[model samples]
Target: MQPDLTVSRTYSGPICLQDPIDKELMTESSLFNPLTDIKVKVQSSFMVSLGVTERSEYHGKAHSGTFPHDSNRTFNPIHAKNKAAYLQNLSSLTKRSDMRTTGVFGHLGGRLGIPNTGVSLLIPHGAFSEEASWEIYLAINQSEPSLQLEGSEILLGPEVTCGPPEVTVSTPFALTIPHCAEVNPDHWTIHLKKKKEQGKWEEVMSVEEETTSCYCLLDPYACHILLDSFGTYALVGEPLSDCSVKELKVAVFGCMSCNSLDYSLRVYCVDNTPWAFQEVILDEKHQGGRLLEEPKLLHFKGSTFSLQISVLDIPPFLWRIKPFTACQEVPFSRVWRSNQQPLHCAFSLERYTPSTTQLSCKICVRQVKGHEQILHIQTSILENERDTITFFAHDDSHFPAQMGPQAFKIPYSIRQRICATFDTPSAKGKDWQMLAQKNSINRNLTYFATQRSPSAVILDLWEARHQHDGDLDSLACALEEIGRTQAHISALAETQTEESHFSYSRQNGL
Candidate 1:
């Protein structure tokens, strides 16, 4: 005969276990003791009970209203509870508007992305059990409290969070993050760090090095990572050699000084980060200066070479440069450590006559043993009603914010055909596994197996791996090798041709 136990939250009475067969009642103290041999079965309408077998021994200190830890104590619920609380608090700090959420089903995985941030998460099919589902979220840390960087360490991308940290997934998911570093394996060291318990950040892995648990594939503008767990993740880069490079945005702003005949030009070189550029724009606005021309990207190397800024091709008969040196040289350390303030050189030029309304010259910015950029300056010296030099505001829409399926160079129709053709298991070895092998995504076969359509997941990885500069001909060739029909191969080629023509037409404004 089995014991009958009733548990109720509304009942404030003491917890008791009673056996109908033995007609004996046990108190909470003896019922929870390690030495107790009694097994009580709880029946409740409002709650489900987990059964514990008879002779089970409790090994650790008992706490009120909590389960006892096992002898080995591999996990502590208290610590887990604390960590959960900590994560929840941090999550609350992020505004609800900044977070993007999507429904992820166990049988069918989905993706979550934050627009304009170049951050996305791909949840594979069967990451959870058939009955499991979750509302996953993706957010970028763009609020007042920003991530802290150590000495000589730079943040290459936005700090992103993909969580409900307590939710567990059976397989690894792909996370794509944008980075600004000019990646060179020999010159730079990059680390992926995750926020751990008590607000401590721990290095998850090095981008150039492979780890057993995680894999990182670096692209020109982004990084695709395979991770089993989820939390806050960020990319940090440290320069390892003088050849290491960081991108900088160079812009020239000009305005007429207090004297109408005198013009001042301010050349600014700042980190390519969005915030840094925005700050420069805001300051330029206050100084009543207008953008002389569109900004250009400079690949500033970490070499010890100093940067020189000079103006050339100036008409000596029409204008004369001020009393400073014709070329200004900036120290390597001063430009390399520029973050809070942008490095700039100011040049004042006096016109021989107020009637000289046009000024044309070449501004040369160069670094020894590095790259050089020449900006062609052609603008009206005096403020004319028909001045061709118009102020142009910065436009960020030209840059891609979202990268996932859209990043694939292959046409959508062709990709669908490939997925359908290779997804099924074939005895002839013309299946998704073979496709994965060809694409170099076969290392984690077990991870792909859990996905509903392994072929699609593999294609997604391929898209992320080559998002910046993917070659479509390679994929078409691979399809042919997998026994795809000539018709299918021809369709890919035709699509590529049509797209190329369309791109050419758009560029030529036809």
Candidate 2:
């Protein structure tokens, strides 16, 4: 009566296709499909759920904005799940001295930074939901051979990582990274690269290109990025022409050879990164070489040019250079690759007579077809009177001490408050410059200006200069001279309070 019907059903399991039926079998079976006999069934109550429905609904109800929807963007769920492990592996491979971590609330937001490293991250007030909180970390790669540069490609900054990549942010965040390359759009092509889940680096965007996912604002000393993702990032430069330039810190270190009469001078040309310079300083200390002068910045261009170093104005009658040629040349690759270690040109000089206790000469450093720097060196070769004065000035018990913010007589909190108060420029002569002058940091104003906080750097210099025998009264007096009596008084009170607490604790043996 219903005309025997053949039914075809689809299942959610593996699908299989069968071969065409034979002509004889088709004819033997009843013809089931007539336009009128076939019936289709539809379920109106069924619903389909996409994976993003929960997130979408939550975002709509909890926040004023929604996540970006780009059909072209592909996200790997597996990668997101394993991101923490990947970051941990990276952290384990590099030194953690420069790493900084902070807890951030979703509703309040917060900032994290590595002090004096020129690296910071700023999260907006509503980057996450009210219930969300995260432990954010920022670190710079400090291990030797941490990164490899390709042909003609130069690393402009340290390899930096901001992680716990599993955490999601609803809004874009700001990241500031410092670079050593001189900004010249015409001669250099700069781009930001991110490490992919597979351990390969992928270019995120060119600083010169226009994009909606991220924006880049280049400053003289740092690069500011507005990005929505968290990962490891680095700034890379490709020299478009020979005119492209990189900034290097040139330092000269010298020591009396074992022979006493023979003096050795070591000239170093390294990337201008602060960490790189600090490494050279540590090495020099181990080798007993004194810094000849304040380090100077050298603009090294992309041209494949060698560096030439020679001693000029040497009293010919008093000293003679040991080399066949007074001037020595260093290859371009050698200096460029000095980021990982200390590379220098050694010059040996012999004094004609031991009576020549004082050495005075001009050391000339020049880049072929580039800039040149002249350093005046005058010191007592035998007695080291300058070092002796410094040594005696400080307590010899702490002879090998490293000076830092902790060494300052001022409490860290008060110093921070002072920096925040005075870092702002004013019409009246009451800014960081005045503060520096008050503290006797009168030179290298240009260098200080290039830092993120000029006042903080000035204080660091003051600490280094007066680590020993530095009194809180002197600093308080200086602050008072600058019309900051309130801050000055507060600093003195806090120091006295801290000292009293320490004494009480010692008496109780706590």
Name the candidate that leads on lDDT: 1
- Output the worst ten-in-a-row residue range by lDDT, candidate 1: 45-54
Across residues 1-510, which tens digit of lDDT does each residue of candidate 2 receive? 111113323223221223221122123323211112112221110000000100111111122212222344333322666767755664564565534443333443545666545566666544666554555667677765334567787778777788666667776666777777889899988999888777788888888776655656666667777667888888888889988888887777888999978988888887776556656766778888887767777888878898888888888889988766578898987766555666678888889888888778888888998999888888777544744312111223222221222223443434554566557775445478888787765544665576567676565444333333434444544554554333355568789999999999999998
Candidate 2 displacement at residue 275 in angstroms: 3.1
- Candidate 2 wrongly placed segments (more than 4 Å): 1-93, 96-107, 125-132, 144-151, 336-338, 351-357, 381-384, 387-510
Name the regions of candidate 1 deviating beyond 4 angstroms: 1-153, 161-174, 228-230, 255-264, 271-297, 317-322, 337-356, 381-434, 437-454, 463-478, 484-510
Cα lDDT for residue 249, candidate 1: 74
Clashing pairs in model 2? none
TM-score per model over all chains: 0.57, 0.55
Candidate maximizing TM-score? 1
**Candidate 1 Cα deviation (angstroms), residue 48:** 52
